[model samples]
Target chain A: MDLENQKRVKDLTEEYGPENVVVLLGAAEGEASGIAAETVTAGDPTYAGPLTGVSLGLVVYHVCEDEVKEEFDPDVYDEQVSMMEMVLDIDEIAEEMQAIREEYTKY
Target chain B: MKGAGYILVHTPDMITHYGTTQTSERIVNPESEYLKNIEANLRPYERVRAYYPNQTYIGNITPLELKEIEGPWQDLECPVDERYGKYGEIMPQDEFYLLIQAVDEFELVFLEKSFVEATKPKLEQDPIITPYVLGRIKEGVESERIDDMVASEDAEGLYMGDKLVGAVKKAHAFDPNLSAHVMVENLVSKASSALALMYAVKNAGIDRDEVEYTIECSEEACGDMNQRGGGNFAKGIAEIAELSRSTGSDVRGFCAAPAHAVLVAAGLVKAGIFKTVAVVAGGSTAKLGMNGKDHVKKGLPILEDVLGGFAVIISENDGVNPELNTDVVGWHSVGTGSAPQNVIASLTTDALDKVGLKVTDVDYYSPEMQNPDITKPAGAGDVPTANLKMIGALAVRRGDIDRKELNAFVEKHGLPGYAPTQGHIPSGVPFMGHARDGILSGEMNRVMIVGKGSLFLGRMTNLFDGVSFLMEPNSGPKEEAAGVSTDEIRRIIAQSLRDFASGLVEAGE
Candidate 1:
């Protein structure tokens, strides 16, 4: 969400190539109770355990529910199981954050 | 003829989502290992990386890369894990649905009306499926139609859990000639084979029509009452892939079919019967989850969920692509005992000896490359490793290599097995795609593909079957023969006839 975090994601994407990047959203399974999103690319320091217990992370590619309806396999991401907040486009969000940082620095 | 393309489709749903369907029920008998261990095994993953997009599987990685990787490959860390190679991406479940839909040549397979509606957009988004195949998909069939068909036991519905995803209709109305069960098996084989054909066309950049002949060498049988195994899977797949000019027949030899088929294709080319011949095979649904119980018992996911398919082309000397060395071919003679040493010797050493080469002549050897991840848990041991060791032991017996060098021999000549145990799939053919690349790239030369089969399972014979062939770098342009014209041949025949007539006249005088 922050500019620094956006840069971190962008750097990771660049390392694995944008096409190789897969955005994973974790399910609330064990101890925790919220859908948490994480980005997986080629290089990462380590895996930050999911908010819940062991979770088979789901791929969250689309940003909106309307977009998901058209392109997503409901079997892969279900309302009963998957969390919505986990859907973040690292590339798109990173670009937006970069623009905001540029404007702020100009001021 | 110019090139080869290989594709592997992973049907994870067959393991997790479609487990309740009759197909699964048929495959998973009550006393079967998979069914008994369902409660213990980890849920199958939604996707696996090995069956990734074309770029990941075909374009990104070459056979050289796969061969170069040192064995006991699983120990290699991620991104590099034997499970996660550099080349292929693990295709998602939705993509597979789109693929099966794309390759549905006839109206036999119907996507559930609701599921079709739900997946249309995703299908549209698919990058690999041809526009023609994708365009054939229409609005879903309604629930009433699917329900009536299911209720009447007229159709077998494809499922992703309780929800209906698709259904396959029977080919015949009254005759058991085309029952729903036979129709489904044939369709799956056809669809998968067609996909392999499509990939061959894509990878080779050749028109489907250029494939003059096809040879289908899978373990599945497709025929009616009169002739059970009397089949035409090759033509069925050719029809689906729209190779109107190609005609073909099926080759059956249990697991050894692919190798035998390759030899057949090479011979055809060598004899100038066909300028271009493609050897292809589709996957078997019957073998799905075959080792699931063992995997589940070991707290592992069902590794045998993927159906494997491959297609390789053998054409006249292209001077570019690898050549199928016709001089050296291995066969398991009737007298060749079933001992491991004998089989390996006949398949490797004996064949090489004819060419004045030793067992170590081949830089790489591919023999029944069944993935250890799946086979080890099932107590079959590491099949590929065992095969390499057997070959090494044979080499030692021949004094071709030192007994102490057996491990090094295996390490040098054998590769980590990555093929599924889909009977014929785990045979030698899985490595052909890579072997072709390796030869062309000068990464290596003289790779041998050995296929072995159990004929006893057929109940008609107690014999074992196997055949092997070597693939090597092109020797350069073949010397062309100054061919005689038809007119010249006609003149020669006339002169010979005249001489015979003159001789008869002289004898009468």
Candidate 2:
């Protein structure tokens, strides 16, 4: 995850309280998406830069995950993120996001 | 013996406008939300001077002094005209602008005639820039040329007090690597690093000509399209700093570069390869306003406004200054798992174990010392404090300290974060000047300097990188002939001969 994005996630979690925040990741790779999800839910697993040891424990989901896709307006999701979704392995990304959220997310 | 002297230079003016985050954002979207909020939060030179961390950075105040002050340092002011510090100085943006032009050998940087005329006198007053260096500044061109270049040639305009004062022209026609913005960023790194080198030479009380080798370890890469990361920042910085005798190269490991470079310098000195080696790095404009959006949103001052540069002179054992003990350097190996516990252990306990020392033995630990005022608002929390906690936890795991004593251990060995998050700037090297002072004054026996980097950012490998080494008071000068006098050698030889004769007699009997 980008260091600035990590900061934003942490700031937003603090501002709205962790229970109110939900991180939506858009990484094409499962590992990348999982890492971003884990950074917000747990701390940065990579132990790199600012997010190291900073566990916000916020709810997180990948854009390709069904839970997130279901929340979006069907036409809007199809119009915006549908093209990239075809190339990405949705199952792999969704599974990784689920795994991270289950292990680390507190709310 | 290693690490003869050290100095750190802070350039607060380059942060907001030139930092990579702001510049890259502006390039992608000129009307970005971050850019809109930047101007309002941009800190003036006066406020930056008054900021406690800035004062501590320049050595205007000590770390302890900064710790004693109240929270939200932006609200508190410690106004002073002094720009110099025991280690280095906090240079204003105006003089730094002149320096960028002065150090520009490629003619990429151009200043407005009136702006130069107005600022040259002030720059001339700087004690570090000798007349020979001052003469390097070219007479400025008209604002018409700057305006034309910015409009047609895609030059990045240089601003002072919101007034167009100069511009940096792109070096290549279409190569993104040599774009005007990149050139300005690289030049800023080079010039600020050179300023740091100048201070290092001055503070070390050595002639610039005595420096034989320089290693630039900044995050910036100086290269064209063919070899995108090809670099010679070391020689580039040396040239501007008037280190005529210095030959050098660049080392890149993201934030870990400084620790690597410093270790390499120490090795070179210890091996008698070089009498004096200087590890120098300039600040990144790209990182200047890295957390500006967060600071702005939080109604806090843009704390990431400083471009940080530092130079450490490593020479053959001086018998007085603190020596870098390279015998037991900590390294995060290729196979080291990327777990936080693993990273901290590799950099702290693993290294200490090699020297038969425990975590509690090190008087101080300097690791990513990013100022909390800047990072806390940015949601990074206190970076140094986080690192210290990890180290402390490791200590508890190793039975070096009890869990109940963790806070006390952290308070004793850790310093408050004060360095700007200029990538390599904050990594372990910031406390070197203080460590040197502490060792010399007998206040501290040893300090561990650790640098950690995220290699995944480069997309090459997921493996993390880190290195650490100890700086301790020199154990006096090495004696001639390994401390064995000729008379002692002769006496030993005689004693051995007598013993041999007695043994022969016994055997014969």
Candidate 3:
């Protein structure tokens, strides 16, 4: 398990109360929707810094055109991680997210 | 009357070789834990005769081969499950594909037999071998016929054979729509299992017009979410069965569909309404290996594999067996209690009370409970075993049977083999085929096929779990005739009604 997903599990357990909930995530998406949006593995960048009793999730921006699809790099989806970083990285993360979002819209 | 005629079904062989197990704890698919539990608890038929060895194959449902969407999902993506906020994380179609993977899909678990054969050309023939026919062939000329069939130059001749042909003809005469062909299906997802069952029935030679009712018990889903079994399958299946619309149309119950279907068949038989009733189902393959990853990732033993399908034909003729405990009672953890505690006790006590069988009298109790050894450590909490214990506790509490008797009961029943953890399919139905035998043989009097579904997980509020039960044929009055021929009875009733109406009219005037 990735540190991130493993951490998310811990967080969800505490947040929902283990007895009341099981760890479930709608991981897949479709055009304008989540395709097979069933589940995601533990290490996906979607969850970060979740610990002890905190549940966390990442909202993906849909950049729906083919031309825009070319501009995205899977490796750079670091907003969740940056959110946990010291205050300094917030602007950079936010800026990058905006740029990525803007680029997808062009297509 | 043929004592509760038992139909023992095993997952199609091709399926086991390639099928996957549904691992989720929820009971969304009909083949979830509840269904599996009933299967596990049912007794096996000792007199084994394989019928309809040929499998029926349905059409392919392969998705339009995935194409990269012209644009990113953001432009085209549809609103998705809230839990997944937009992340241009993956391909749009993959998202839909994977989302379906998570739930207990009906089509993926059970496959149609002919579907399997359709995939493999060499196994071209689909045969429906009944118990009586299997017995006669086995005793009379199986080897010789096999040789003759093998010797035939044409595959059709081989399969449609002089011997096989005769048998098929005989079956066709009895049920003219009966196809001597066996049905099979390839694994896609669990829903195919249910589809396969429907496909089998329709393909088996039961004309759509002759079929007054089509009871579906298998867990395959014909519809996507929201639509719910709304597909051309009814048409596809009807075409396969060659049935027409006037014959009527409908499905019954939740997971206990097959059992419900049987009761319907029995009722039709008893009520003198319909003569032939067919219970058919297809399981999904999607649930396949749902838990394999959890086990493999955690380094534990793998629990379930491929999905399968089955179809049973119930008729009123003395040719088939009849179940006596028609007084079948079903209950769930409703009104009287809550989870963990009430769920167990209420369901058990209520079912037992109906037949006046103490925990001791019930040959076995089926609760689509999880297999403790396989599920306990996964934080599942040993639901099946706990269910058994609850039954014991109830018996002791009621002063019906003592603790020693409880131990004896468990000992006699034994923990069934580990089943797929899919909440519904694995529950009480898996062992039903076997338990049915004991009922027919008179070795066991009252056996209950119980099913329970947990609704809370689906996030569908206001819906509590549901439970249903079915009793197999046990002993009853020998030759307890129907009292009157159904046709004649209907005719007489019609005449009496006409006279009564005329008399009333005259009195009014």
How do the residues A1-107 of candidate 2 rate in per-residue lDDT, one tens digit apiece? 67677777777777899898877877646766777788887797644436778888888887778877888899777545653443356788888888988899898
For residue B397, what is the lDDT in candidate 3? Answer: 52
Candidate 1 pairs with clashing backbones: A30-A53, B49-B90, B52-B89, B56-B87, B56-B88, B57-B88, B63-B434, B113-B140, B113-B141
For model 1, state the Cα shift of residue B339 in Å: 2.2
True contacts kept of each: 0.00, 0.00, 0.00
- Model 1 Cα lDDT, one tens digit per residue, B1-509: 35555555566656542333224434424355555455344333333442222212333444345556544333343242122122122344445565565655557777667677777776566444567677767677777777777668877766664566776777768657577656666666666777766766655545677788999999877666777677888987777677788999999999999999999999988898987788888777777777664466567767666666777777777555678898999999999866556677789888998979988888999999887766766646567777887788777767888878988998898877777777897798877776765676588889999999999888787888899999898786574212545574455345434533542353233
**TM-scores for all predictions:** 0.71, 0.79, 0.48
lDDT of 3 by residue, B1-509 (tens): 12111111222221222233332223224344432442232211111010011000001100011011221111132222111101001111111111112122222211123322332232111122222212211112244443443344211111211122111111122331221111112112222333333333433234435555545554434443345445333234333333443132334344544444555666776676765555544444444444443444444434333233444444443312435245655555346434333454455666667766555666666665344434533434445554565566556656777756765665454334233443344556544443443454456555666565544444465344545455555232235444546674455345434533542353233
Candidate 2 chain B, poorest ten consecutive residues by summed lDDT? B1-10
Q: Tens digits of per-residue lDDT for model 1 on A2-91?
A: 223445556665586555554532221211101123222211111221111322222333333343444667754443222222222234
Number of colliding residue pairs in each model = 9, 4, 165
Ranking of all predicted structures according to TM-score, beginning with the best and ending with the worst: 2, 1, 3
- The DockQ value obtained for model 2 is 0.04
Pairs of residues at least 3 apart in sequence or in different chains that clash in candidate 2: B19-B285, B19-B286, B20-B285, B20-B286
lDDT of 1: 0.63
Report the lDDT of model 1 for residue B102: 61
In order, the first chain's TM-score in every candidate is 0.28, 0.93, 0.22
| Residue-level error in angstroms, candidate 3, position B166 | 36
Residues B1-509 of candidate 2: C-alpha lDDT, one tens digit per residue? 22222333334445546776666666656776667767777777767766778767766566766667766677777754356665567777878888888888888999999888888999887778888778988889998999999889689988875677889999988999999989988998888888888877866656788899999999888899999989998998898888999999999999999999999998888888988999999878888778776677678877777778888888876555678888779999987766566788889889899889989899889999888887766645677877887788777766788878988887888888888888898899888877776676688898999999988888899888999999988776575235555675565345434533542353233
